[model samples]
Target: MMDSNDTPVDVRLSLRVNGQMRQLDVPPNVVLLDALRDRLGLTGTKKGCDHGQCGACTVLVNGEAINSCLALAVVHDGDDITTVEGLAGEADLSPLQAAFLEHDAYQCGYCTPGQLMSATELLSNRKVGTTDAEVAEAMSGNICRCGAYKNILSAIQETRQQHAGAAID
Candidate 1:
């Protein structure tokens, strides 16, 4: 049936967000970032550059880091999506979050959520090395307008070292 006055068809997506399964009927054109924020009320994932040029909307899709703004909600059916809210424990902060606070990795705090999510993936993937330059290059997609690159790098490195040390114990 073709009609000029018809609205776009809404597709049902079953997404596991922050360890909870959620069902949503969203339009095919709805971006993952909008779905997470507008529909699920997970506002921790910031919307910086909607075009994916900025990494403010970064989130973990099945443990891989991706820009939420660039992904369509309909395409992520049955996928695991982790926002910044998922990074912390029920009573305490994750190691990375704690490191960010200890290292003062943020200035304005607007980009911190995306920065944390991206850092979590980077640390877990073993793609980033134990160097400041490597961390910077790996995190290049995230843009912190306050220019807290040094502190962010420190937090990532420290968290990595902590995990490495824990592995030995």
Candidate 2:
């Protein structure tokens, strides 16, 4: 859309990001990943494989994990979004974050944010199986170029065990 002066108009969006209400005026075509990183300064969500093949841009939208690179910012107005930055509390890291650290789940750390976000959703989902194979299959979308899949899987399993009966928010 253009104004009378032929200048592109940015769409206003209100989103509850990481428990904070954030407002941004971005181009209608701006993907959620760009909006979060470039506009809101939340660079934890990486821009790898912008085509959405790699899950490096994964983020929680309305409590579900999605590839932010595939979602338009304007369409998610009022949606609750969670990036890797929001995984921790005021003074402590979240269980999954701690698990990742304890298990050394990352090598280069480029894909760690996406891994954690995907694991977060997986843990909360009771439909996914508890076996390592199931977990691995569920997380196949997020590729670890450094070949840290074993450690990543360990961290996810450990965290899943810890929150066995509890519902992860």
Q: Against the true structure, what is each candidate's TM-score?
A: 0.95, 0.94
Task: Give candidate 1's TM-score.
Answer: 0.95
Score each candidate by Cα lDDT.
0.92, 0.94
Using TM-score, give the best candidate's number: 1
lDDT (tens digit, per residue) of candidate 1 on 1-169: 2237786778898999999999999888999999999999999999998998889999999999999999999999999999999999989999999999999999999999999999999876675687888888999999999999999999999998888788779
